[model samples]
Target chain A: MFPSGHPERSAVERNGVEGSRDQTLKVPQRYSSTPLRSVRNDEKVSRHSSLCGLALGLVLIACAIPSAKAQDFLDHVDEALSFSALNGEVRARVSGTLDLEVYHFSGLSPGLIRTTNDTLFNPRLSLFLDAQLGPSVYLFTQTRVDRGFDPSDRGAQLRLDEYAVRVTPWEDGRFTLQAGQFSTVVGNWVPRHLSWENPFVNAPLPYENVTAIGDKSAPYYSFLGIGTPAEKYEHNPIIWGPSYATGVSVAGKIGQFDYAGEIKNASLSSRPESWPITRMDFANPTVSGRVGFRPNEMWTFGFSASEGAYLRPEAMSTLPFGRDPGDYHERLFGQDIGFAWHHWQLWAEFFEARFEVPGFTDADTFAYYLEAKYKFTPQFFGAVRWNQQFFGDVTNSYGGTAPWGRDLWRADLAVGYRFTAHTQLKLQYSFQHEKDGGNDSDHIFAAQFTVRF
Target chain B: MRCLVFCLCLLSALTRSAPAQGSVEGQVDLPRTKSAPVMTKRYEIVTTGGVLGTNPPLAVVYLEGSFPTSSNLPTKQVAQKDLAFVPALLPVQVGTKVEFPNLEKDTYHNIFSYSPAKRFDLGRYRPDEKPVPSQIFDVAGLVTLRCDIHEHMRGLILVLATPHFVVTDDSGHFRLKGLPAGHYTLKAWIDSRTTREHPIDLKSGSTLQVDFPATP
Candidate 1:
């Protein structure tokens, strides 16, 4: 579901191109910056180009042949030409998916806010390239191109979502070491967050919400009981399980048990503003890991943990309240389970995080979500999800007006139809309720189409 | 002189009559469940009495130990259309070759197998493209064929060394004729399960009958 690597293509190419049967063509290297007169005078370049063109033409002719044997011969030629271009090495395989979504949101809150109702469109295109450099070494990169028509979001951008180099010292992939920017192995959903894989349009509370409240352009409203002063909102603690961080990870499987450990530059709460501008704090590294066991194909259970600094020492010192920067550590623990039987799939996760605040006592927050999907038929499926976040009472806070411990819950219902193996359409409706004086709530409806190739 | 003529005639008759050939006939009892009706109505199991048959044609009956003298067999083809394998199940000799051709237009297909008998991948290819060179089944075992892009597309290949084989008809009846009279270990395979071997001795010009119990 996470867009598994395709070793099949390489296997076929390897088998189809016999070593003794293929003839390698010598390709010439030409620099476009060279003078035009110099290029025209180069005999070797002209001959190489002509030979390559001739080979292409021959391949086309071979394909047009009606006989199966002749077509096979032409296929070999095409493969050989491609092989030669890659130096007889099939190093990389490429795959990608496209997802587009249209959604409308309506909110009811205590304050007089403009644009209580809004509609927007979001589109995301992702490409994955996995290169097997050697039998034991591999490189993988994922790039995402996105466009968001929201006033408060980044308009359009192309970002390198994940880039990692993995080294498998063992032959059977029982042990692996990966380095670079990659998804945090804290929970089950983040790794499978693609639109086609996820049953719902939006992520659960633990991954989507509970981030630094002040990071967005919008102002923080105490519609929920938990409130933070506008000046100190930047330090608000939220679980950042869905984000990717620059780090090195070690992962492998032993029988039915799988484990992954990561040492990242920053905690989930402190993800960089953007992937391109990521900056690591070498002195304060975050360690996160998950250990899971699949008793059988039908069920999987996992436990995850992370401990690191959520706020930078410099940023902690500039807080409005008298707080110590050294005491701001974030520790998180979680348990997750997945079950699949017949046409039904269920997944649930519970997360509890303890944050050490400078001016206040440690704030403990609990977040969890349960989701279930049933496939009435192979092509149609219906799903429902319930998610909530509860903030523990805060003590020794400088300001009593802050919504110290607010609670929020959301419910989602969705139905999806798969037109083909590579295409799907999903419609989802969700409602969010905040338990506070104002009882703020929001209604959201979304439709998404995803295609993979 | 009459006795000498008679002896010559007897010798000529013996030479003309080669080793006697026998036939093996059998009926396979397929396991049926009350739930089968629901599955059939859902189109999960086609009742076409062939590749996706519920009984009879679903099983492959063959003899072990004895083989044909010739090893040269023409290549066979399995095509992809309507998002399904033309023949969901195929049986061939150990050294036979199989070709998978995509017949759909403007679509891509990939064929692969991880069975220990034959592990290979044809990669993703377009329609009308040359099929991967015929896959040679050198090992005698079941090879599960699957499409990586389409999870539901599945096919099976049964490679055996013996040349005496037959697939049961709609009535669950099968007959293998023209087999040289001898002792043989008869086996029947249905889906992924195989029936116990029934050893039998065939007398000259005689018919042998064997039946396999239904499997759950």
Candidate 2:
């Protein structure tokens, strides 16, 4: 429901449908006359069911031909035929990185510190498949794989992420919905890296450490529960353009700015009976919103914020049928700012988080990164970065780190180069120090390669 | 009749070809990339910023310029190559003659323009062959150009009175030359999807450099 006298409606009405919404193609599917297409094959054993399946199959074939063409190719009749319509594109990317670090403790002098080097060269791969079903409906899917650190080594049963479905009912696609698993709409940087289309290597602290499930967290960091459940709604915006929201999202435009907000339930935890599996839930319902402005064709800006209580699975109880209680809540707040010129880019972000424990002191943390880049060539650029992290209230954890409350600091210097369109290489060196005034510091080094298709 | 022939001959002597067709060249500068270089046989670079390629030549380029728009109705024009339509952007006036020079060595080509503004199709013809003299664009507006055989070959016939446009070069530079002595609206188009416009007054031989910024 939209608020009365909301400023965005008029903006949408005036500016027409937003461009982003218009271009996004949906995934394709055969809508069977049987209605319930998900039924198992064994269920169609009866003669009546067999007849129904055959009739449904015939109807689907009739509907599928034209529908797929319209939806996928914007109703281009010439491209509707299998021989006439080429319905796929080859999307790929390649990227790499290097990280170096020097460690020092608060009590130890810089001379006594030694460097513990770590390097990574993981290749990222992706495949995006798109097809049109009709003038108003289409289908698309992107599957990705990575090779570097064994996810199972990191306690993950499966390493892959992202299998999503989207639908557009309207011809112009001003209003649309997306269903299926997708990247959490929590932050800008966590979903996709700058090298893939972003401007920086590290996400703002709030985004890097909060809600997102990956290596960018502390020993007690949160993981993506199972999936973000719910449908996302987006309306064409007027001025700044289209905005996206999920989990009961409201999107559209207001005057010269585009805005979006969503309220959704995130998984907190899950545990199996008679098994050692204790899945954590970040499944609590949370709210997030973003507003963007575009004054002219060249300049654009956006601001986003979110707050949610993430469930901690490690705190789960082994009880057999009793309800498990949620005992920890992490509050996140952050801001992002970015700008792009013809050949130059600037981005900076700051975030602060507070982890609330039922029986322990509240742990607070802050992280920030500032970076600027210039495109020396279409595929090459140089940049300087400053990144810092502060962790406070380190308690002891089973993983060998102080519990939720520990204090530490890190500073880094980085330079990056891109050799080809998708291939990139980055080298970074950072210095980290402990706060307790004791001498425990080590050096860190990392290198990574990312490829997308 | 003899006096009319003498007058026509004198007029023909005075007429000359449109200014030897000079080229407009420029470069596009992109911000440095942060990660390792992407390795591919050929990199298809696209950004919120934009990429450059001619509808006809199909050469890859980086560009920064005004986006083309259909707000102000212009005459429809079409460019054809092979059986494919080229230059995708065809800014012409109503009743303008669009020459379809067949660049393909073997196939026949047919050009068609279908839109609310104009609708007409030129029957097929072999290479080095000509379609009925020319198709007259009687309507003013955006027209979609297509070929019968090559489904991917598509272009727009932007019929207009003023030709205030330029395409970005390999380096992303564009310049509109030889403007009429008056104030006019300048618009740039990319892929017929994104467009930007501005009002400017130019001297007959002045060159203006307009830099289009990549969306952040």
Report the number of the highest-TM-score candidate: 1
**Compared with the true structure, what per-residue lDDT tens digits does model 1 show for residues A129-189?**
6555434666677887875211112467777877877776875446778888877788777
The prediction achieving the highest DockQ against the true structure is 1
Which CAPRI quality tier does the interface of model 1 achieve?
Answer: incorrect
DockQ of 2: 0.03
Model 1 TM-score?
0.54
Which 10-residue window of candidate 1 chain A scores lowest in summed lDDT? A24-33
Query: What's the TM-score of chain A alone for every prediction?
Result: 0.71, 0.53
| Clashing residue pairs for model 1 | A210-A238, A226-A403, A226-A406, A227-A403
**lDDT by residue for model 2 over B85-182, one digit each (tens)?**
56655666455666666565434444554354665555454445544325555565566665533333566666544444444544456665544434
Worst 10 residues of 1 chain B by lDDT: B36-45
| Cα misplacement distance, residue B170 of candidate 1 (Å) | 33
DockQ numbers for every candidate? 0.03, 0.03
Kindly list the interface RMSD, in angstroms, of each predicted candidate in the order they appear.
20.0, 18.1
Per-residue accuracy of model 2 over A393-446 as CA lDDT, tens digit each: 322211111222223455544554433222344444455554442333534433
